[model samples]
Target: MGIPQVSETVERLWNGWELRMVMLLSLYLQIFLILFGRRRKYTAGFWIGKLVWLAYLSADWVATFSLGILAQKIGDSNRGSIPAFWAPVLLVHLGGPDTITAYSMEDNELWLRHQLVLVSQVVVAFYAFTRSWWGKDPLLFVAIPIFVAGIIKYGERNWVLRSASSEQYRNSVYSEMNELDSKFDKFSNSEFFEMTDERLVREVDLNGIITEATFLHEADLFFQMYRVLYADLVLGDSIHLATHIILRKKSAMQAFELIEVEMGFMYDVLYTKLAKVRKSRVIFRASIFLCFVSALLAFSLGISKNNHAYSTAEITISYLLLYGAIVIEIYSVVLLLFSDWAMLWLTGKRKPLFDSVYRTICSSGFLSFLQHDKRWESTMAQHNLISFQRSKAKLTSISLKKLLGKSNIQSSKVVGADLKKFIFQHLLDKRTRYNLRMRSHDPGSNDLHEILSERGDEVFGREESLENFVWSVKFPDFNESLLAWHIATDICYHDDVRINGGNAKIIHQNTETSIELSNYMVYLLVDYPFLLPRGIGKERYSQTCSAVDDHAELLDRIISVQPFSWYESAITFDIEKSTRKVSALWAGVKLAKSLQALGTQDGWGNERKWKIISEVWVEMLTYAASHCGWKEHAQTLTRGGELLSHVCLLMAHLGLSEQCLTTSRLD
Candidate 1:
């Protein structure tokens, strides 16, 4: 059997006219997406553009059959032209350049690989173009605008990156100005501001500065109590909010983990609600069916003879390609429709559910409930045990003479003014400066040995009191473990320590309280604010006040902890890391707020802007506390909301200026 031949004329028409038109259209679509798509709406543009490009690249196969048929009519004997000129060109396009790729992040990586690919593709494309001298020069014309558009898109992205740095700098300076105004405004309205007696929210002078050291110290002071407020949240209480925030922050893996945790907890909460489960199943099934039907129709049309299919081999391949696409679309649509968002809404009005769950977590009256996982429990226990031992030591002091068995020298007399002697004589072999600070006096060799003995016993569970203790020390381990414990500290203790005017106690109390209060306030604003008191006689009002006080104390403590010797450590906590931790807590709260808005009478149409504004307010609050530092506490308000507000003001001014510029340009 002789192979069918494709005439040169038919082959030229297939490549020059049909293929060029499709490629040109795809390029235009990509350009449209780059200009109009919102930052958050990239998913829509990405998939659509991807599919269009795929189709354009695959269209050659579709043209092959028609060209072969035309050639056959012309009585050509040799097999049809392979369209080999396009094959290499298409390969070059697939490789992409340094400026563009399949992903946005890839553009930012070291460009050696991209440059190599770029050079190779350029060479390959030129070779293909030289070979592809068809009767019409359709590709050259089509490529021109496509090339221009690609350059513009690449340049625009680069401009955004370069411009954002300056924007942030200008934003910072403007923020500072706005912060001064806010402080003045706050000070002026001090009378209008309600005062609280709780240790956490006790009004304190900020001393007119915001330094990094102070910021971290203050954050440390209150984050503990905030962690407790969302014990349920931290331990996986509100799955919908937690899951949404995780996904929003682009932490899909963590979001899935949170979902698993939520599902397990929900199974316990909704154990009796068989009807809800049945409803979910029905929705899931229906969505799946619809997706399947759409995909099957699309696939069937693609495989039909009117669409493509030339030789028996080509027909088989085309059917397979169509089948794969159909499968992909069906799965995607099914997943989207029955997603976490849909299932959550279908779970019925869950505002009350969220509230009930939150309250149960918060007011269980069991402090133990606040700790998550065994590691946290161990850390807390270490904190408590140390405090308890320190209290016992203060209460029961042994004289040096008694310890020396009636020796003439007193321990205090021998130690003199040096506390190191006191510590080493009684407790451990060596002592840290922090240990001396904890004692409120220097520790000598005897004192050190005694302290170490007590510490070891507490740590190793040598005594019953030590074994039964809830926390081991005032502070636990120094690294990730201790910090995590501080985040879950109790509010009452913080209040007491603040009243006592003790630094060690205040430090512990304040850091935990502040972080907790911030987290609590966000949650209240977002999900459980109804539990908060409106004006007076609200049951949770006192609790809310306490949380706020703790937060204020946290802020104060952070200011006090400033001027750390190593400022580099402070700068290491860049925006991304700070925001990651902030976002994790914010996610649950954001979900709650969104849900609360939805459940209201008007369905949230008018309130969307305000809701967004509130979130901005919270973001500002945290960012100020975390980023602006103790010395720059005054600047905290500026970097966030005040700064953003200032930018809006600038844009307004800039817009007027722009209009004037345009008038001048026209004139």
Candidate 2:
């Protein structure tokens, strides 16, 4: 074929199917998002988040563009009736899925921008409907209910966005707690309601009811109380007292499980519509469902009369659209029926049919995978500063590890049972000592919050043998302190690896826990500094890495740092130009030498050495948790929840935070 003929044929085909193709694409994106969007919270790999994000953005653009096309078709009076009906369908797509709304906390803040888009699209859709053969066509009446359903769904999207906005979320704290209070009243009459604050302190077994159901109830309750902490508000006495006592009786794993459920609920609120219009969600869902079915049936009947006017492909595509809409409706209903909100709603309701169906579905293996116990991937991201810098120094255009982000120094470890037990036991032991002091001297919680705020000085104060090593802990700033300890920890860990040579399994495993925490903390500094208290951590990290990234001997065996300076660019942190006689990395080396000297002193061995380091690392973890703004913690929940956030919540449950009603800021 000649070029002009080929172009004409391509143009003709596109004109015939442009609207149809976009409609199908819009539906496909809707399906893609609803099924996989929630996976961001549980699934591993960077690609899933990126794919969901792409689909999330595409779904809106395609739907909006379709609305514009429909308006133009109506104004031209070409396929006006069918195009008018489709405008509402585009609105349904614009509403998006129940699985996600805002991809990040930043997306939630742009809710006003979404509001503007919603207004403009609604206007265009309305214009399309009016410009269509309204009076002459019976299709107008059939389109009305569909438009109502579409508007409700789209409006609900904006409502959730607005509700999740930072300004509104902070205001939602008390209202959530108030709702929780009502649920507590319902539970007050049952055996399931046994874990009152005072009761939890004395109870041996942790409360009553079936396992999963009990967790949902507790999740609802805790999210209500601790969401105040999430909003950075002061907790009332009643909220903290109950949480402290309940956490005291439970094992570390149970405490973490409770927090996971709490985070899961928070995720639902910020990223889904379940937490919005809770009292009326059922009514709204039913209304939209009925309207949709009505429109489908109306179209099915009305289309037969106009079958002669439309082409076979157009007819086929229209049915495909209808089927896709039905599938989406059914899928959303399934999600709703099995959702945490559904579980919460079913908690005290003894309606036999709903109750039996709910339990059977939850217990069935066929659908059981949908009901997971944990809400996140449960892996702590690990990055060794010395090792990562070494690899980064050698990075080149053809480096496979850089291309794939497959650096061994940067990875994640599944937070195992041993680690959980150690962490819980450590806190349990701390609380026990505090209780002992209360019994003998009554030091009050004022000192406890002060200690909670310490990065490592608190650990130093409690151990006289660690006094000489206090310089590493009590640095001039938190960022430099983190860098110094990170390097020192890496050195001691590697030296032990060389010395131990696969000895006792138990002792080696203990060493692994401390190394993991050390690596994980440094990982946070490099990748997720927002989760920590405000610091020049990234700057110090860059300075440290830039200093030693190319040092062959140090890395073969590798490290540096400085304070944040507005006047000085990070690139200017050249090692030779530093004001200090001893550079940051060299200071860490000196500290490591000091620790190595003490490793065998006073009958101390590698075992005791790592134990002190392990304990101090935990203190640093808690310090980061307590000092970080709650808003930062909440923001991490949508991305599978952070270990820091979990520890932070655990500390609050144990009454370790300044936000705890029993603790006063001594400062």
Candidate 3:
């Protein structure tokens, strides 16, 4: 008898609290998304991303579930008026945060499905509102403005999602290019801006003064011209011709800054509600915020007169939902004002006052979070080959770790200043010059890609001193080649450490650049293999790591004490996993010997040898950058992006793309 009574009482409370619980959960989800969704653009971590991902997926379900519960309670006279008023509050949560419209690029492709669900949900929302207290209740009348705001919010999400889809995005790009062609009837009509030879980019009409606003406009221009690259489309050779003519004149610093701005635009296009820059966005912002304010005012007044009739819990929840929503909506509108989209549109208008104030705030750096992110953390994750082995060499298979995407890495470093300049200048001079000559003369995408994707071998052919080391690139699969080079680079780097007479001594700049690029490549292979050319990289990597693990003590001794040759006792070349284990270590040792021999062969110093090694690594990096598919590049933008994606976009602008160097998207 006691158990039965307890069960009955528990069921009663659950039935009463189910709708309220779901309502609060849906609001909490909206709060979570508004606060944290933007972090995925700039933060790099597993747990933060997972939390936001969970919240993004759950926000919609809870809102829809709340509506279903309300639709079921339409005739319960005491609760009906409260549920009816709360129904539209659920719709505002369904609108989601302005910071996130789609979680991934693939989510944008499913806009039609979202639209169908939107229609069904709107039908249910209306049914629940109209069935209860229609003409009799003042609460139902106050819900009218909230209902309108909810529809606009939900519909705006679907619109942005649709605009970001591939077919819609590509069509818009083509239409804008046609408009550009119409505007440019003659070269003489175009006005020169940024007259400095090192930073010049073509603009239509402006005084020669370059403000912070000018960078936003410049980013808008570059994004318009090159945005098609993100979607894997081809551009006409003329767009290629026009871009390279300007890019070639830029210094490495100016060049990277320009690319950073363009990438910021790409991030907005993929992740946020700003799918395209337009004046219509301003109007939408005004409409949504005004609707929210009007609803809050009407609801507060209506509820006060009927305050005695509703339950205390019902009144409290209604106030929380209203006040919380208006606060969030106000912040969203302020974010829109400070967004790159708003700044871009505002900058384009030459109307005097807005442009000056906008530029002043941009340069002032008052709200640093709102500033267009100039660099994303400026750090690269570091996962060295031997270090990975030393850390993760238990008996379990690596296949599971790969499947779950658990990285063996826990270390990262700021991308060194000189390393960035070194890579920028190398691609600026070598890859661009070579790719342009080939593509302009012959335009076969596949054949051109195959030829240009020579990872390190081409560098050998170009440099006379490194001809003897060409076989290392030629003798293995690309993955094997990476392992071989990584092994050799590590050995040579340690040898330099010893040669400096102390491990703490600052080495040559070229040696530091070589090791940084080398370790970064291994990080990509281990953690983000899809960004690399299709390869046996992970398999080869695991085997090489095992090799280092087996002989860690001996290897350490060789580095700190004796010459490498004294460790011959440790070698047993089991040929089955030739690219891994002992055989792989031998390959590295042999290559290291060859590099050292080359350093001593003539009048060349350590600087000459390190320069060759660093140049080869840069070539390998660019080769991987170009050959990675554009879709992979687009997907990485959500995870704070990758250095390889940054390089790939810059490569396209300089005519070194794996594609035919033809794409244009301007809106």
Candidate 4:
């Protein structure tokens, strides 16, 4: 059969309209990417994440498909007469979006595939350029340098991907350890000054002037502590001292700012080229700018000379390409300048002009918006399984109203508790006591749970039986313990008013923390099973669900008498006696009653009672956070992140995880 041919009308349309449409489409995709690329970090909504994911994948595909079409056009005699200038423009588009390099950690590991794509695309772009070359056209001169810049930018994305791969990142950390070890050896024998009990009672004096210098100093100190994250190193006593010094010196807001900057650096290292190009950022920036300028100048000269036969549409498209490249470059430069990386670099220089500029930018509302905490991490999405189940049970009008989207909601409710500050304060207090006790006597091979329990005992005046009951250090199954505690917390929370009617303020605060932490732990249990301890969270969840279902008739009666009173009635039915099997809810109710009875029998004050409960909750939270794998934590970053993951990292940095033991062994 003879090869098929298109009609002249179709050919003309393809040449004149379709090609420009694709180019315009590619440009629009780039614009979308620039605007929405960082939205995933700030949002945990299903649609927003899906949209960003779509844009992320589609941007590369559209650019590549358009380049293929351009290549096909280069071979057609009729379309061959059309300006091939768009070929290099497509190359620039194919360099991919700047706002994201890798969507997730797994993407970083696929750098080899991207490298192959880079080679193939460069060859295809070059083929299109050469086939359409008509001997020294001024427009071709403009395209050449812009193409080089595009290649460099694209190559940079892949280089960053390789550098950030876990293996490569660990290697980079290991590379620095020889110097670290030498310094460590030199300091190992130096006797450290121990603070006396009297000196410890007096808070560390922090009267230094709070300025950019002070903030930078604290950031540098924290960054040193954070570097252990990359190296898989234990946060030793040096890290503990650094954290204490910084926390003592800085206010909570200032301390959180340093943390934000540290997280920003981490985000860049994992998902951007910040670490890969830090040293040569200025040089790379200048090179890209100069290339764009050269392209702009060459294109302008070509327009002035009118050396080639080009349609007005083609000429306009060329102009858009040149201007778009320059404008995007300028935008990227602005982002780089206002970034935490730039701030860190400027702080290191200690120049007055740089400091003034930094201060001015920091004071601006726009810069604040750019560097806002939300940009780095979203407020964690709360997902309590029991709450979720209650909502699903359709038991209450309020939950039904929320389900039907009729709660007069105007914005996403800040439903989750701000536990970061609380966790930090608790760790700080615990570490102080831990250091004191460690100095006084040997801790031996005691794990994190033991240490926390020992320190907790000291704080609460040694309630041995109570401590053992609340947090059994030798408990073999974490999942079961979590279920028991979670249920107990929920029961106690609902029964708070009945238990402590007079002290509203203390009861309310403790109840809030207990409920929030309880829900968060259950969220991990049901939604993120891998992050929980070694048992099957799903199987346990299924068993609980089956038990709840089996008691449907009884639950209906309870709900009829008092809706949302499942916990109240659940306490009466002993799980051990029930035919359906031991229910988590029943176990929880027993625990709650026992705890309340203990409080009454011991004549414990409201403060002491709540303190004990909160301490136990913190211990459970720490246990889960410390036990969850780092890979599991990293996996959550692309999904607007999770509080569990943040807590995990925080626990590791605080030297409260068994991973720290592994790291110590490495040393």
Give a tens-digit lDDT track for model 3, residues 202-248.
33343333466665665566676666666556655445444565666
Worst 10 residues of 2 by lDDT: 558-567
- Candidates 3 and 4 compared: the better one by lDDT is 3
CA lDDT of each prediction against the hidden true structure:
0.28, 0.71, 0.71, 0.61
Quote model 1's TM-score.
0.22
lDDT of 4 by residue, 1-667 (tens): 2334457667668757887787888887777766666565545666566677887788788889888887777645665344556777777776665667888889999999999999999898888788677433335666677777878888888888988887787777664544434333322211222443333223222123136555554555455555555456654443444345446544444555565555555666777654423657677777877987887787777777874556678778777777887887787777777776677666656667777887888889999877665444535334554445554566444555455443322222242334556666766665555442234223454445565333123434466557546443233566666676776665555555443542435464556676666666776676577877787566766676666565546434432323344345453654445664434655655666676666666567545666677766776776676666666666666666666666555544455555442222211
Q: What tens-digit string does per-residue lDDT give for candidate 1 at 23-50? A: 3333333333322221111121224435
Ranking by lDDT: 3, 2, 4, 1
TM-score of each: 0.22, 0.87, 0.88, 0.82
The positional error of residue 69 in candidate 4, measured at the CA in angstroms, is 1.0
Worst 10 residues of 4 by lDDT: 184-193
Q: Give residue 394's lDDT in candidate 1 (0 to 100).
A: 50
Stretch of 10 with least lDDT, candidate 3: 185-194
lDDT of 2 by residue, 1-667 (tens): 9999999999988876888898889989999998888887665456677789899989999999888887777535355335356788888889888888888878889888988988898888888888766535545666687788888888989988998887898887777656544443332222223445546423322243344576666666677777777776765434554555667767778888888878888888888765623657878788888887887788778777766545577567767776787778788877777777777676546466656766887778856677664387778888887777666556656555446644443778989988988888877766654431233223352466556756767677877887777778777567677777777788776665555562334355667887788888887877678877676777777777765653445345322221222123333333335454333575666677677667879888887777777887887887788788877887777667778888888777666677754422111
Predicted structure 2: lDDT: 0.71
